[model samples]
Target: MKKLAFLVLLIVTVLSGTLVGKAIASTGFDAYSMTTHKIENGNLTNKVTDLISFTSQNIENEKNNDSKLVSINNVSDNVIDSSLSTDEEILQELSRYKDLENTYLMQPGWTSITFDQYDLLPLNSPKPLPSQYRKEFWSHFDGNQKVTEQVDYLISSETGKVPLGVFVNGELTSLWNDGQKVKKDPYTPAYDLYLVSSIQTLVESNSPLELSFKQEILANQSVSLIELRTQFSTTDKQWINIQLDKPVWGQYEKFTFNSQTGLLLKYEHYYVLDDMSLVLSSVTDNFEYSVASEAPSDVTNLIATGGK
Candidate 1:
């Protein structure tokens, strides 16, 4: 009986040690472990919530401008003959535009703009209302520097479906839809206007990717012009970022906004070491709303039907 009790005690001790070791291993000092903890304890969730609240307040506070929808009648609607133009030629043409160096200092406009990925209609689908259509705008500015700019979409009136966010100097400035104050600035309204013009030029020309690339230049941080690397995944039916030859890191080294809706999409980042070497560092960190259907039940059917 004494021997049996000793054996049981030894087994119990071994099991306890195993459990403690596992607990330590699971809570190790690695970033992944810490991230897991943050996710579990709702710290990340709360931070996201706080960010959303801050954005909502900012959108609420934005001064509603009485400006009517100005006619784009003068703007040429001639689609760039993509059939006659090579990608290289299109990119070269886009490169001719001056890049915005310090868009972070751009001023806020009175009118608010928003984008909705869900509003996208298939290329063959019937046309929707102006509000249902996702469009970007470009505005020109002449201040201390000459800068051209673009925004994702602007609704004439409030739409419940519009995503909550604001762009200042081509970068996301606020998340609130009501337009409350999130950040103040030496805000340059002219820069925003320039961007709006640039966007119009690119879109009307049927050069969506070029439009995105120009935005990259305005947002680039480097001595030399950044080299753009683009790729499309047939498996995923999404465009992926392969590389960006910029000096400073962006929010995602590879991913960028959708040219049509300004929505975030899966992108890859390529890292170059020693100025000449290259490597694909990461791919598709975030997935946006489906480029196709929305309903969960529809996903299976869509996939079976070869729709992404």
Candidate 2:
């Protein structure tokens, strides 16, 4: 009988040790194990690195065929060599060419043009527009065994634009653009920010920003004008600096929104640093959201009882 009791105790002790170890491993930052193995020394890490490097090299090799207009190609290309023309006739001719110039500016596959030509057009000309709202979901392993999930939304309007909300794990957390509630996990704010910014930038761009085969299709399509992309160099109360390869390619606008419904999406000019690097360092806003129906039964029961 004593031997049997000792064996049972030994079994219980072993199980307890296992349980305790698991609990400790899962209690650290972001609910990930603190002592988990890193990819730096793993075989899979080397394979992933090689694959990424190969893909990047192939992308760089794809040459851009868009012609760049640097200066006046032909001074008399559009000129009518009529010395007898009156002032009215000259003005009429100029107006006709101005319309053609605007058409060329809006043509497909047109990447860059002279600044003088762009300035000759009216300032209030309508540019590309974005959809009402855009949502994106991303998941990745954070070095640890745990996988992180993020959901971001870009809410835009006719006059201003801003990041409306985010969801990390079914909970309401930070509200940035206006007082719109962004539901997310409280523990992973940085992760939320990264996902939100990435989606917002993509949805706000006038053209495809990411270098991919999709950009070719976008360039060919007339509706490509409405496509949105964004990058961050700096952040401020009323302004944001979005990086671009060329100024004429697109305009970087500050993220703005309506105070009431939190539905404004507009872009304004901002400056880039002199260093000219494309990377933008920013924090992540990580969180999650849950609908009332999705809440715990105990919480719902409490709410129902309190209403009585």
Candidate 3:
């Protein structure tokens, strides 16, 4: 019983951190769309891979890479082209985040991020929470995650299927189920962004794995798909040492890209951590992006009502 309580506590803490950040300003471009998924893991694994060194000389030699090009003849719309690798695409996206002035999230069916937290410590060891119970427990969450540059918003899927917490310029007011603003948390921060403009340097950006495995398939009526099991890590100059053993927690990502346009249709980001005591945890993010001609009604309505 005590172990279960502890597991709950850890999950609550990390889960809260997974949600929220400043969002891109509204561009009124209904065609832009996105879906963000975050998976939190806290499980240990006995399996290990002695990844290659991140030094310049040890990286993959792409000189004659054209001869080693991976081709899939039976392809469609989901395939990734040979010109750019998956690692390059990911770096491009993260860099795009850096250039964006304002980003937005939590738009119901349109632009929203779904955060799922999981605890995979062994139950007998007073660490691992059973996977079966995680679904239901995590299903009930109150979050204020957005694409903006801050983490002070609130939304609950369990509540009327809308973002109940609304912030206007710098003021937060609670919106009830009837879509009316009411008094809630009356605080907001000044015009300070959390991540985008603060960091001066990208200390290190490295891909830990190269060509561990690859698969080819046809998806979406003809896009060629090249599935790559890749890994990456990045450090920023603004990061301060918090007495953690390894400041760099790498991601084991599975990417599925459309070979034609060099676009990423879907991908999963996984990371693991271990507590001082024998408890190990893992986190994952499943991300999806699309180009639409219009925004969903739910999101449009939310904006129409001043984020009500």
Best by TM-score: 3
Q: What would the per-residue lDDT of candidate 1 be over residues 131-241, giving only the tens digit for each residue?
A: 122322222234542222222222333443232222233233212222322322223332111223333443455543322232322122211111232221232111112
| Least accurate 10 contiguous residues by lDDT in model 1 | 29-38
Output the lDDT of residue 290, model 3.
34
Please provide, for model 2 over 1-308, each residue's C-alpha lDDT reduced to its tens digit, 9 standing for 90 to 100.
Answer: 11111111100101111111012111111111111111111122223234335333422332232212111111112222343233333334333433433332222211111010011101111121131222222222233323233222233344343322223343322223223332333222221112223333333443234211001121222110011223332222112112223321212222222122222111112222334321111101111211121333332332233211
- Could you give the C-alpha RMSD of every candidate to the true structure, in order shown? 24.3, 24.9, 14.4
Name the runs in model 1 displaced over 4 angstroms. Answer: 1-89, 97-118, 121-142, 146-180, 184-229, 232-308
Better of 2 and 3 by TM-score: 3
lDDT of 1: 0.24
| Candidate 3 local lDDT, 1-308, one digit each (tens) | 11111111111111222211121112111000110112233222323221112111111222133212111221233433344445445454434543331222222122333322222212222222222111110000113322221111222344323333333333323332233332223222111121212111121323234422233454332222222222222321112111223332322333343333333333332332232111122221122233222445544454445554
Worst 10 residues of 2 by lDDT: 113-122
**Candidate 1: deviation at residue 34, Å?**
36
Model with the higher lDDT, candidate 1 or 3: 3
- Candidate 2 error regions (>4 Å): 1-208, 211-238, 241-274, 278-280, 283-294, 298-308
TM-score against truth, every candidate: 0.21, 0.17, 0.32
Tell me which of candidates 2 and 3 scores higher on lDDT.
3
